[model samples]
Target: MEIGFPNHPRRNLLKEIEWIGKNGFDFVDLFLEEDMATPEKVDVNKTRELLEKYDLGIVGHTAWYMPIGSPVKALRSACIAELKRYFRTFAELGVEYVNIHANWPGGLFTDKEGVKFQIETLKKLVEEAKEFGIKLMLEPLDTRFDTVKNISSILKAIPELYLHLDIGHTSLYGRKPEDFIKKFHARLKHVHLHDNNKSRDLHLPLGCGSIEWEKILKLLKKYYDGTITLEVFSRDRDYVLLARDKLIELWNKL
Candidate 1:
């Protein structure tokens, strides 16, 4: 399994790229925040050049600012516009997969209605993405109360679309990561590998939380060929480095 690190616009991009290369990661997940969402700030051609220099592959994470299933029509439109721009950039960079979050709850659409709308949105996005040879993966988020809790509903709605399973979130919401893997085995494309305490989304390292790594890893190895991005962060750089090291070690053993 190939390992990857997450990149953000707030962080020094070039420095992070160089660091990933030096630290022996195979690829990087470009987390497209609002500032870096446009082609202006992040020149795809230049970014590709750097990745080529480091001999790294890229998988993109879509911007978190706009929710695809927002109740407001204007917000949804804006979100789509940003995503379209991102897709164009991905095409130029030769990036294959773009990870996207599913519809946020509290929208006009009910849980079921939201799923339908999201499926339609994704269907359109996938068609557009095909032109650029990029595939979109829908991610399921864990919520506090009653909401679209897991990926199962979304996956059921859009069977053809790919999946970006966030293992940490799955565990946080009381679902077995292995179960998700087995159930969504066919559509699973990429993964966000992190750990979290039950109470909050802490983004801890693999062994630091309650997730069962060996079982999950064994199940993952059976199906997935995509990068496992360690999505953890803290104010302390040492903590990040330690988590990165531990994840690499675990991946090697698996």
Candidate 2:
């Protein structure tokens, strides 16, 4: 399996790419987010050069806060337009899959209406992705739509969409990571690996949380053999490296 790490959006995009490549990661889960690393701020030509220099692959990650599911028609349209703009940059960077979080509609709509808005917004995105030859992936977040049943509904509506499974998120919403794997393993195109306390999305290193990594890795081995982003968020960069090593060890053992 090819393993990678995400660039903290608040940091320098080119510098993060250099470090990810130099440190022996297979790719960068390039998070195109605000304050610094947005689509407009990214230096695409230089970023591409660095990735090629290290022989790395790429997966596109969008800002999780984008309100694609807002009940307001204008807001949804703006979000879709922004994503389509980002897809052009991803295409230039040789990215194949671009990921977006499941949008939470909040109290503005009922669960059914929220899910409906999400599906309608994503349909436009899927069509836009086709024009750029980039596949779209949906990552279920802690929301009304986080359950497998809701996720299944979205996937059924958009047959061209793929799944981006985040192991940490599964802990937050009373859903186990295994449930998602069992239900949609065939549709999974990308994965995010991080540990959580089963109460919060702490983004801890592999062994620091209550998650049963050995069991999860074993299940993944049976179905998924693609890009996994080590999403350990810590001030200590060593934690990220330690998590990476732990993941590789457990994966090999399984």
Candidate 3:
């Protein structure tokens, strides 16, 4: 399995790339978002050069704030257009998979209506992404949509859409990571690993929370052998490094 690190939108993308490379990560989950790392602001050619220099692979990540599942057709179309812009940047970077969050607009629609909106938007995205040589994956946030049954329904609606499973998110709302692995392992193409307190998505380092890392790793090994990003969000770089080491150690033991 290839391991990766994500660039925080608050930091310089080029420097983030260098740090991931120097730290021995196999790839970078390039999150093209605001405050710094927007597609218009990022230098794709230069970023590609640095990835080549480090021999690192890339997976595209979009900002979670986008209202892709907005019930309004015009607003949803605008969101899809914005996604295409990111697709162009990711395509230039040779990214194989790009992830979008399942950000359903609350109080604007019923649960059923929201799913319909999301599925419609995803269908267009999946087809358009192919033109750019990229496959789109749906990332579930901390909401009802993150449940196995709910996610499965969306996956059924769009067979081309892949799953971006975040272990940290799964730990919330009385959800078990194993349920996601067992149910959607076949659909999973990329993974995000971080620890949380089971009540909140703190993005803590592995073993520093309520998650059972050893068990999760064992199940993951049996089903997933693809790209995994250490999505830890600690201020100290040492915690990220430590999480990576701990993950490797756990995977080896299993």
Best by lDDT: 2
Per-residue lDDT tens digits for candidate 3, residues 144-253, read 66777777778899999999999999889999889988988999999999998899889999999999888888999999889999999888989999988888888878
Which ranking of candidates, highest lDDT first? 2, 3, 1
Question: What local lDDT does model 2 show for residue 17?
Answer: 89
lDDT of 3: 0.89
Clashes of each: 0, 0, 0
- How far residue 78's Cα lies from its native spot in candidate 3, in Å, is 0.8
Residue pair clashes in candidate 1: none
Task: Give me the overall lDDT of model 2.
Answer: 0.90
Model 2 agreement with the true structure over 1-254: per-residue lDDT tens digits: 99999998999999998889999999999999897888889998999999999999999999988898898899999998989889999998888999989986777567777779999999999999889999999998865368888888899999999999999888675678899999899999999999988888899999999999999889989999999999999999899998999899999999
Error of 3 at 133 (Å): 0.7
Model 2 alpha-carbon miss at residue 54, Å: 0.9
Local distance difference test, candidate 1: 0.73
Residue 208 C-alpha lDDT in model 3: 93
Which model is ahead, 1 or 2, in terms of lDDT?
2
**Which parts of model 2 have CA positions greater than 4 angstroms off?**
none
Q: How many backbone clashes does candidate 1 have?
A: 0
